[model samples]
Target: MEPIQLTTAVMTIVNASRIIVQFMQNQRLKNQARRRQQHGDEDMNTDFSKATVSSNLEIMVLLGQAHAVERRFWARETSTEWWDHIVLQVWDDSQWLRNFRMRKGTFMELYDLLSPALKHKNTKMRAALTDHKRVAIALWKLGIPDSYRSVGNQFGVGKSTVGVAVMQVANVIIELLLSKVVTLGNVQVILDGFAAMGFPNCGGAIDGTHIPILGPDHQGSQYINRKGYFSVVLQTLVDHKGHFTNINVG
Candidate 1:
């Protein structure tokens, strides 16, 4: 044989492998950050169901845009498939299948809110049984008014149950949204807004209104404004610049 140069070639290959590994690590971190930005939310917590987590992650990845179509829903990979293939393979062995319907954060909130009422042994209705489905159905109906009866039918409950569920979820959502999105003003901000309109002393303005309802039970008071029928008088307060301050919804 003429010559063999295995050692030199091996060293060069090892150095190249190290550089390649570092590049891949950097690329992966950058990809994770880009993914976070694309979704507009942080990554999931550790305790979340693996199947649900994987399903959500795959869905988000495949369909991240406004008009993204879900291939998993079309039949390739589903929650059930993910549960069978990946979730069960993990050692923790959580009930990822049943937990698939609920996002972990929402599930946690509903569980905390309804655990007391649901824990009662005497409770019989479906709503009192499972807070996960109840909360989901409630949220779905709030945005889709027409689907109330349909969703109720699916759950073998009345439309009123759906309404109640939705109202509960809506109340929680409203409270959270108000706290986070609504910017509260101190006495200074209020005074500044009023001062802009040259009405510093005026705390607010009062306007009288009436809402017509079924015929009056008393059938005597004629002070009920307009509509030529039974109505309740309502007084609303507005700020100097016409911002609504308060309303006595009688």
Candidate 2:
């Protein structure tokens, strides 16, 4: 983990040293050449040239050192794709689900089902990312509302990229997954199971839940419920199995 940091520090030092030595050597050679080329205003031109060369060499060396240091850090980070480490065996399945909000197999199955539609196109600039990676990015974003940067850090992507992934994946889920996963057939199964438990004719139970919100501008007071905090109402139909058979947002 720290080996990269140590290597980068060494690279910075080496680059600075090289820049200094090369600058000094170049100035020495230029001075020698200038001496050889000196045929007019010997002392005056020599002093002026020496001063100009010295200042320019110092400036160049500073700029080179800055650039090399920047390059070293950038190079160190670019080589690693941390998202792979999370998806692969570098991290355990438990950790993956804890962060991603779904089992690995479930995520993969979803990715496969949606890949044809969700998979990005390979443009002239770069190849498209895999469907699994895109889904992971979306899951992370959904799992925490204020976690764009955190998700980006874990997935080795930018916050804007994470946001885009979430939007695309969410559109796919709303279009294809929602109806497929929750339908009349699934609702009937839940009702039958609840009936078997002696809760007859009860299709689903209704419950009102208050979900606290920061409230939208211009009409925040309207959203303030009896609980004191500004929140929207969530009327949910939950089955005996503790699954949300249906939900109505207010």
Candidate 3:
């Protein structure tokens, strides 16, 4: 080959190699730019996530503080209980006996007589009166004819408790004390008692009376009396000693 032609060929080969090297360098620059863009996007995303986490924690803290303030406000606004004022503030035995019209011994005795059958549980959640207190309440209802609310206020119990106690004691007394308190099995003794009262040959003396009662639900007019009020007939039989021997009530 001639020297001039060989030199021209070598120059062409060197230019081609330089072109390839320039293209590779451009590709590497593009790759480095893409890598830097990706890393920048990742860092921005991490910073945004950190900001979001900080905001969420601040919101949770605010909610916790709000709830604590609300709870404290409610707790400070609460009131005292009723039972605390009533049972501790005003309770007297003499006033209790005067209101119930029975001695303590007699009340306890009657309670002992009727307590086995009068085991009634209060459906309402309240402080329950003892057996003696229950009997006293029943006697107060019978003797004084006071309102249940008044009796409850005086006795340091709820009105419902007073009403329930009266009803339970009355039911127990009627069921269990009827046979024991009034009986006619002792006919000779009853006749002798009548004879002592100057009424001979009479087994017993029976008397009829009317007791004032509240208007009944079903028949209010039927119980109206000459006094222009409701009443129930109470018939009683007694021996000469004034003790009840036989009794009938309607």
Candidate 4:
């Protein structure tokens, strides 16, 4: 063989080996890039799964809160057995007069007169209270020395309901009956009766008393009377029949 040919053959072999090395390096770089892209896709999928789970948990929590509120909306339950079972069925006429400060007949007559004004119809929430029950509640509150809460317990109603009923009954009575019942009828007849009783020319008797009261927010000291108690003055005049003709309070 010639020396130049041998040298050319060695050069060719070296060129082929360099080409193979370059091809192997390119393949390795492409493999690494593909592995990195796969890892990125996996991470994106994991993040999306976590967000979906979080949203579902938030929806479940809101539903639970809504159910809890619904359960607590109307929790309190009061008994009506006192007025329905005991007072209506068990009590007698004497018991009625003692508790309400009037006979049953008078109470019914008053109910008949006032029912048109005080009547209420039943609604979706509850039954309306009877007119007689309302009248009894008001009379019991006025005649008995008890708190509104106590009166409500006996009447099978709320304390606020008792207070409202008392005010309503009182206002109605004043509007309907005050002028006719509290007036001095026939002035000469009243004077003659007073004269027969040896009180000449006197039509009525007048007196004043201290009514016990809670100390007011303003002028509290002024309400302290000579008896060392808080009170308001109630002055009244009465005819010969001992019926009230005039009244004043402060």
Candidate 3's TM-score reads 0.57
lDDT value, residue 91 of candidate 1: 21
Give all candidates' CA lDDT scores. Answer: 0.53, 0.72, 0.67, 0.78
Per-residue error (Å), model 4, residue 30: 47
lDDT tens digits, residues 145-176, model 2?
Answer: 66777777777666777888989999998888
Clashing pairs in 4: none
lDDT of 3 by residue, 111-184 (tens): 78888876656534333455656776678778887898787776666678788988888888879998788876
Q: Tell me the lDDT of candidate 3.
A: 0.67
Candidate 1 residue 211 C-alpha distance from true site, Å: 3.4
lDDT for position 72 in model 2:
22
Per-model TM values vs. the true structure = 0.30, 0.59, 0.57, 0.64
Q: Kindly report which residue pairs in candidate 3 clash with one another.
A: none
Superior by TM-score: candidate 3 or candidate 4: 4
Which ranges of candidate 4 are over 4 A from the true structure? 1-75, 89-93
By lDDT, the candidates rank as 4, 2, 3, 1
Task: Look at candidate 2 and give me any clashing residue pairs.
Answer: none
Candidate that scores best on lDDT: 4
lDDT of 1 by residue, 1-250 (tens): 1133455445455555655565565556556666666776445322223434554554454333322322222212212233234443552424432433444455556557654443323333222425655665664554343566776765555667678877766676556544443333355667777788887765666888666555666754664555565677778766555655566656
